[model samples]
Target: MQHGIHPAYRPVVFRDRVGGLTFLTRSTATADRTVEWADGTTRPVVDVEVSSASHPFYTGNARVLDTAGRVERYHRRYGRGDGAGH
Candidate 1:
């Protein structure tokens, strides 16, 4: 570890906007916004679009992509031998 060359690491709150979830963790990232946490202290808050709370995979709401079907359709439409090494 080097001294005086690293970004400051401190507790930060990541807030998931869609799911309304907050997680407290240490990070070197900075945010201009601050939020009052449950523990009655204010910390820097970062707004995120997605997190485990609302992510489709983590929430078991994911839609299974029909990749094979899509590939087959693409092959049929484009004549499969278009230089993909078969």
Candidate 2:
């Protein structure tokens, strides 16, 4: 609760790179530019590559990689006999 040393914390706009959608939230982070928000006021704007609303994992595009299959394939190709049919 110090007076003049703390950075300002207020609602700022965060724009999603893919959708160009902007949302306002409070943080002490600074932005290189400012933007007019949906509420008719201008605030500092930060361009973000991903957010929970825009990330592929949260949106269900997460890939389940088959590491076990890759390891088995590698061993089958390089390991000694008791050979697996090609």
* Cα lDDT of model 2 by residue, 1-86, tens digit: 98999999988888898866778889998988998877789899999989877887888988889999988898788774456643
Candidate that would win on lDDT = 1
> Clashes in candidate 1: how many?
0
Residue 70 in model 1: shift from native, Å?
A: 6.0
TM-scores for every predicted model: 0.74, 0.74
Clashes of each: 0, 0
Q: How does residue 52 of candidate 1 score in lDDT?
A: 95
Q: What lDDT is reached at residue 25 by model 1?
A: 100
What are the runs in model 1 whose C-alpha is more than 4 Å off? 66-86
Error of 1 at 2 (Å): 1.8
